[model samples]
Target chain A: MLFVFGHQNPDTDAIASALVYASYLTRTGTPALAYRIGEMNFETPFVLQAAGIEAPPRLPELAEGTAVALVDHNETGQSVSNLAQLNVTHVVDHHKLGDLQTNTPAMLRFEPVGSCGTILLRLYREANLSVEPLEAQLMLSAILSDTLHFRSPTTTEADREAVEFLASVAGIDDVASYAMQMFAAKSDLGDTPAEQILAMDYKEFTFGEGDDAQRWGLGVTETTNPGYVLGRQDELLAAMRRLKDKEGLAGVMLSVVDILEEHNETLVASEQEAAVVLGAFGVQTEASRASLGGMISRKKQLVPALEAYFEQQG
Target chain B: MLFVFGHQNPDTDAIASALVYASYLTRTGTPALAYRIGEMNFETPFVLQAAGIEAPPRLPELAEGTAVALVDHNETGQSVSNLAQLNVTHVVDHHKLGDLQTNTPAMLRFEPVGSCGTILLRLYREANLSVEPLEAQLMLSAILSDTLHFRSPTTTEADREAVEFLASVAGIDDVASYAMQMFAAKSDLGDTPAEQILAMDYKEFTFGEGDDAQRWGLGVTETTNPGYVLGRQDELLAAMRRLKDKEGLAGVMLSVVDILEEHNETLVASEQEAAVVLGAFGVQTEASRASLGGMISRKKQLVPALEAYFEQQG
Candidate 1:
């Protein structure tokens, strides 16, 4: 059986795209199962429940002989465990490529769109298959989540078109209102512990390996108001410190972005990371928190800026 | 105009594939020009002269606004100079990938075939376009040369089928006799100058840059009999030293392989490289030269063995 999956710490786009792609393959006479590398996050479960669709199974270790297709990610570190051992037949991704080498020539459909679900939407259209309402809703939720309700710089014209088309198919009259409801659900971390809050949207990036490796983490939390996170600074700081020590990372950056205001209030977990953030953002900082205006995208802005800083330092 | 070219040091496959692809694009109503990054080598001229096809234009400087498609090679250092400035529309290559990142998404058709011409052959069949007799001859010659008459380990079933089909189209009754004639023409390098002989089939492989970079040169000369090259060892050595000094390479290796016997006699220019070659091939050496039996294919055996050695050292 073909197991289709995405990157670890599965986001809405990764999980939804795998489900949609696996469904497409199944309908086209291929027996495939959709899987998630990690458990569903806070917002993803809400989206799946609203659409009346079951969550994909969490993937365990796969055998070397099993065939697989990748969605949303192409990096081996982010993909399923022991990715090189399995047969990778295809890659359908939207992110920048990493050091992914297949043993044989595989079909690669990599586009610079906002979400991998957008590519799946195009595939459905090309195959002349009518998408179910639940599938449409899942894809639409993926697009809204990844593009940050059209605020992300990663959003493209293709994403906009796909979002509109999927909205119509799902019978959603007001796209913006639905997106705000989903964002509010994601932002409602009132009773959740600080560690859970930090781990909700956490991601790690590593360059090199072993003693020469440089690794860092970024935890992004999107809220309607930034003060919600800044007010609980002490609790967040303790959790961030615990995570840094546990992971033995170079540093950690927690971004509390006001989605509506299109601004950011970043909390640096260590002095080393504070220096990097200062070099990257040139923003005002007092203690661990910094007030940075008009920087929303972690992919387009933060990661690239930090990578440039490290490359220069080297 | 769409400028189609290959890597520096244009081999038979590189030159012939560019010509074939340019012709296909032109026939399909695109204004394209075939260009070469380097001067023609010894065996390539014979292929073109026999087909009665003129050599492609030598590329000088390209404007930033120009459109280009790469074939055969994709590494930035080996590709056309100032590649980042031009708009790379497409890439069709058969080699392992390098650090190639385009500003925009480009059409990439990377196959693990024996030659770039083999990919072009599949493209022609997919488009249902009948190739001309001269073009068929050029492609057939390219496959034979790159796969070493199906002796190289990189040869696939697709290459074999393409060779037979192209042979039929080119009105060749005996494929083996034609391949031997081409090999004999390449092996007949007695009258050529030593410097020219070294430069004829030379290639450079590099990893990283600056002080951290490791750069090496490989000169492969195929002969029907081994004595033709072994007898002129002194002249070859002097020429190899001159090339090493001119190219600023870390080390240079000269491989004189007898095609009929499928054996390689490699000469190292330095002690450091001699140690590496000894470690890689496990062959005893007096001075810089060593005899390695059944190691003719540079792509499949020699380069991979040397790269493994360097990686282990790191």
Candidate 2:
């Protein structure tokens, strides 16, 4: 039996790749169990609905015979421990190398591209796996989510090639319309409970020193398009503060990435962190700032750079 | 010589697709000039930098011997005179069909998708174009932007498919990471001018019955994660009023498509238009009370319904 594993607090990319990977594995004669760390979020539901696959219920078994594959995130102490109780054997990720990669004996695979969905897309392509339209759509949605719908800097040529290939094979005439609808659906962020908002789309990280062992969970807070973003600015900041306090995070940062500026509206951990680390890289923390405006993707934009800062401190 | 044409004051989908389309055309052995309609925005700069290409200066000879390609919005009778003067041969778009299509006869291609970028990707593939890594990235970015980063309800299986195929070919491994960064980069909306915010990512439409013109624009006033769209309730109504005053429109309208719950936040000309048309179809002005909360796309989600409503009215 094979199992598919993804990071805790899964995003659309994790959900998408996990679903596609499980499908691929199933196609290859493996009854795979797809596992995620936490409960599913709103962003994950559509892909699951589109794929017509039930989320894998928590498994009661993980033994030595179980070969596991990690999608979207690499395996480590911090990685979702779906197979740790059993025995995971392989890791596939598209993010930059994580420190956990050094200690893991699993098939360490990390490619610095945009989405793990793309990684799984390559796997499917390499193995000549047949792609269903819904599965193709799921994989495509994952890529869109991961790459900020393909605006992130980390999205590479391989990502686009996957898009082109998948577009043709799926016989999709126009993807943008479909994707925009999906985005509009996903950004339905109103009247939701704070907890739901917090968990709706989140990424988790274990930062700080060995003794610190602080788990950081940061969720995005967006504003109204332009002028109204000014109105919601204070409310969003307050919400972020509440989340920060509730989570007891080392630093609760929220940014509003303006696609126009190519700069970050930085809400940093401290004035010192912003000045010393983020400022070193030119993230603006001006007083008149609306919010953290220029940081779009939390993974590629914030985590990686913040990881670098902590690494430098280490 | 190939010319990239975009409407004046381009949106994210238009400009980003133009940049990426330029790259696609270049890879297909057609050197393209990324002509700008106006100043670039955050999404454009990020896409340009990520694609490793720069938007070039407009060529004075766009009217002569130019294998002119138009993206996003198309030209109309009211369109800039230069468009009619151009040696235009091809057009790709994602908006509702406009007067420009019937009024003009350049290889008109309008796919009622969310973004024009998705159509451009199709053109590249249809032409058997060889794409570069940066080109793939740009194309994918354009797709995402048009799709509201894939949350919009109008998102099709095809859009997702293209993103996956292009991402893989472009070698974008972790699409989420890149997307997060880009999204984070856009989080700042504090310092943005009100007019700039209004125009930042707005779409305009002009539709008059016979002689007079009834024009309006719809802008996504707010968004966050997965199904929470707090539309700028009052402002959008005001903007519609302003458009009515400025254009002497028979009736101006503004719609906020909540893609998550699959409804619309509409501001129309009269209670006659609203009740006789919108109310019957369940479109309400009470956005916050909208039981249908997930209407996230304007092009695909809102336009068709409006067209149907108008047809029903007739």
The TM-scores, one per candidate, come to 0.68, 0.44
Error of 2 at B23 (Å): 31
lDDT of 2 by residue, B217-278 (tens): 54444322212223343544555567557766455444444333334454554554455334
TM-score of candidate 1 against the unseen true structure? 0.68
Cα lDDT computed for each candidate against the true fold: 0.81, 0.57
* Number of the predicted model whose lDDT against the real structure is largest: 1
Chain A TM-score compared with the true chain A, each model in order: 0.94, 0.78
Model 1, range B214-283, lDDT digits (tens) per residue?
8988988877767988888888888888888998988888899887777889888878777877777788
Per-residue alpha-carbon lDDT of model 1 for A1-42, expressed as tens digits?
A: 789998887889988998988988898777888999886667
DockQ of each: 0.14, 0.01
